[model samples]
Target: MAQQVRGVVARRKGEPVSIETVVVPDPGPGEAVVRVQACGVCHTDLHYREGGINDDFPFLLGHEAAGIVEEVGEGVEDVAPGDFVILNWRAVCGRCRACLRGRPWYCFDTHNARQKMTLTDGTELTPALGIGAFAEKTLVAAGQCTKVNPAVAPQVAGLLGCGVMAGLGAALNTADVRRGDSVAVIGVGGVGGAAVMGARLAAAATVVAVDVDDRKLAQAEKLGATHTVNSRTTDAVRAIRDLTGGFGADVVIEAVGRPETYEQAFYARDLAGTVVLVGVPTPEMELKLPLLDVFGRGGALKSSWYGDCLPSRDFPVLIDLHLQGRLDLGAFVSETIGLGDVEEAFATMRRGDVLRSVVLF
Candidate 1:
């Protein structure tokens, strides 16, 4: 039987999202239905509402989510009904070139539910990140569900589904930050803040956070940033170098995704140091840099996609760490809000007042 649930939906571009009746069908082959417990309000969700992601009108927003599996399709063995799980956007297909090469994190073909959820009028709704989860229940590929320890709160565990995972993966996996290394993260928002925590988890000796807002910088400090630089008042590149004993940081993570910030990250690293670009840039944005500098910079320049994470592998470990008090996932949850408060949450996110405003179901 199909179920009718209230979900946050963006019916048109540059318009406010509303709680609409979403009709979700039962799990089909290779799919599962999850009862969403909580979903985090990410900048990406707002981007979709503004038509920044695509022209897929009537988008079912919200992706950073944790839930309980209520139903599973035939042949689904990984997760069963009643299992607590974190929903991941990337569901790697083993035959993809990236996956075949044993790099499933870079899998070119990820999976989603074959069937579409719809509005009451039968209009097909595109799920944000292919996993529209702001609803009370969402259907996804069985592979999209990653089982984690159920003891952790849904609000905290759900974050591993997106931004937090991206930031942590940027530093720990993409940059391979090491003990005693000097690391600098630009932006200091949810993603950047998570990078700061990732650097701490990696045992980096010095972690520098660069941002325009003092409040975010203060939050970064709470997340384990050894130094903070307000780029609006100080030259970020020079300040990072000064903090790293004049050689520059060993790794610079660009979380702002702007050309100017990219350039700062390019020059703010030590010789042979890595620069990780985890920030999402707009389609119209172009990056122009000196050819000589590109050639002269001896280290790897990389972009982190979803922090290059394998959800099945990373999610449980992160959740366990969070439960054990090793990782402060709770700090990321600035507030818990009801589904109707999504529009207001977007405003709070834009104001940079909170790391995350989660929609608690």
Candidate 2:
């Protein structure tokens, strides 16, 4: 049966999102219907609203979510009705070359539900990141629902579905941050702060957080940063170098997608160190760097897509850590709001007023 649910929708670019009744179709083959309990208002959702992602209007706008499996389509085995799960956008196809090469995290062909959820008048709603969940109910591929312990709150568990997981994975998986390592994370937004938390989880010795906003820097300090650099007043690259014994951080994570921050991350790392780009960049932006420096630096320059996380392997583990109190996932939720408040959440997000304003269904 089809489900009618309230959701936040972006009808046009540069406009506020509206709460509307959306139609969530029944689970089709290889799909699952989720009863969303909570969804976070991520920067990516705002980007989608501003049409920074694409011109796909009438977009169903939330993706970072955790829910209970309400139903599963034919052949769905990993998850079933009544299961608590975090919905992920990347559902790896085992047959993809990346999966065949034993790297499912880089799966070339991740998938979502084949069917589309539509408006009452029959307009097809493009689900944001292919896992829209601002609604009370949403449909996704079975592979997208990763089962996790239900002891944790949905608001916290859902965070692993997107941005938080991406940040943590960038530090642990992409950058492979080792214990006692010196790390610097640029842009202390939700994602960057998570990288700080991840670095701490990985036992980094010195986690220096760099950002322009003092509020965000303060938040980063609680997350695990050994020092904070307000880039608006200080030279970020040089500050990181000074903090790291004048050689720069052993690993630098750039969570601000601007070219300036990118270059900062490029030069803020130690010789032969790692630089991880986890921030999303605008299409109009271009990055230029010295060719000589690129060779001289001599280390891996990597971009973490969803933190290069294999949801199936990482989500449950992170959730377990959260439940065990080893990770402070609850700290990420700045406040809880309803679907109608998405526009306000976007404003707060832009102003760096909150780490995340989650929508509670």
Candidate 3:
């Protein structure tokens, strides 16, 4: 039977989200229903609410989530009820060209449940990133649930579902930071700080964090940044270059996504170094760089989408690492609140007041 559950919904752009009774269809073919325990309030959720993502109105918000699988639809053999899992947006389609070419991480046709959850009035709700999770129970494709170690706290484990994974993946997977390499991360927010942690885990020798907020820089230091630059007053490119032996960092991760910050990252790297862009920019934003600089740089410039993550492979390993105390996933959870406080959490996030104000169902 289809289940009705309490969920956070944004009925229009730039308006506050509200808790509403949403109708979630029972598991269809290849679908699963997860009883959400914890879901992080990510910037993407705010973007959707603000109409930055698109005109997808009445969005069911929240994506970075972890919970228990309560039921699975027919042909769902990989996971079963009672399994603790992290919900992921990317359920790779094996038939996609990227997957067919053995690069499933780049699979273009990642999917979610074919069925849609709706409001009581029959208005369809577009699940945020295909995994709307700010609810007691949510419906998703079976492939969206990545089983992980059950011992990890749901509050911490859910982070691996999105931003944290994206940051770590940007450094280790996309940027390929080498042991003893110098890395500079621009924008020390949730994603940037995670990039710092990833660089530290990857054995980067000098990790310089750049941000406008001192508090965020302090947080980044705890995450493993060896140096910090408050870009608001200082010239960021010069400061990063100065901190990195006057050449520039071997790799620069641009987590801010703005045109100016992108330029700062472009010039803040050593010759032939890498620049990984994980921050999202709006459609009106355009990046213009010196054509000669691109040719002269002589290295890869890449954008990391969800950190190029294959949830199945990455989630379990990350959860185990968190369990073993190697990664401090717990620190990312600045506070946990009920679903009702999502709008306020968005404000806190915008003011740079918290690392993550997770919504606990």
Candidate 4:
């Protein structure tokens, strides 16, 4: 028999989400049903509600989540019932070319559950990022549930599934920030702050944080930034160059996915230095940089997709680091709300009043 659970649903674009009774079917082949313990209020979830991602009406919102597996479908050996896990969107297909090549992080054909969760009227609900977890329970492919140290709290552990992981992976994996390298992160949101911490974790010679807001800059400093720059009232490129001994940062991370910030990231790095764009940009946005600059600066300009992370490998290690008192995963949780508080959480997130307003079950 199917289960009925309360969920936050976006019935239409730009309208408030509502708590509705969602019908969750029992797991089918390659699927698992999760009893969500905590889910973060990510900007992406807001994007989905605003019709920024797609026109998938009546979408099931929420992706950054952690929970206990209640049931597993046939052939699901990786995770079993009672296991605590963090949900991820990218469930790699083992036979994909990227996986066969040993770079499973770049798995070209990731997947989600085949069955759809629906409303009482039988209208299909599109799960946000293929892992709609804002509800009491969610369905996901088995591979999407990465088992981690269960001792960690659900709210903090869940964050590793999205934004924070993106930042850490951008600095530690994509840019490959090394000891003695100078790193500067632009935009001190949850992602940028994590990038700063990643640089510090890598023992970078200098970790500079650039943001338009002073409050965020202060938060970055607390998160291991060696220096801070208020880009709104200063020349970011010049300040970054000055901080880096008249050159620039060896790696510059653009966590604000806007054209102006991207341009700043381009010029704020040393010649031949890497620029990692971890920010999610809107489709209408475009960059118009001079061609010569791209040619003259001979390093890589890359975009990090989900922090170029492999959940099975990265999530456990990161959770361990948190458990060991290394990564301050708790700082990101500014407040905790209920499933009914999602609308207000969205408002708080829009005002930049909170780093992450988590929904606790």
Who wins the lDDT comparison?
A: 1
C-alpha TM-score for every candidate: 0.99, 0.98, 0.99, 0.99
Estimate the overall C-alpha local distance difference test score of candidate 2: 0.93
Please report how far candidate 3 places residue 186 from its true position, in Å.
0.2
> In candidate 1, residue 29 scores what lDDT?
93
Model 1 alpha-carbon miss at residue 20, Å:
0.7
Clashes of 2: 0
| Candidate 1, residue 173: lDDT | 95
lDDT of 1 by residue, 134-253 (tens): 999999999999999999999999999999999999999999999999999999999999999999999999999999999999999999999999999999999999999999999999
Instruction: Put down candidate 2 lDDT per residue, 27-65, tens digits, no spaces.
Output: 988999999999999988888898888997899999999
Query: Which residue pairs in model 1 clash with each other?
Result: none
lDDT by candidate, in order shown: 0.96, 0.93, 0.94, 0.94
lDDT of 3 by residue, 266-307 (tens): 999999999999998887899999899999988889999999
Clashing pairs in model 2?
Answer: none
TM-score of 2: 0.98
Point out where model 3 deviates above 4 Å: none
Question: Candidate 3 — what's its lDDT?
Answer: 0.94
Candidate 1 off by > 4 Å: none
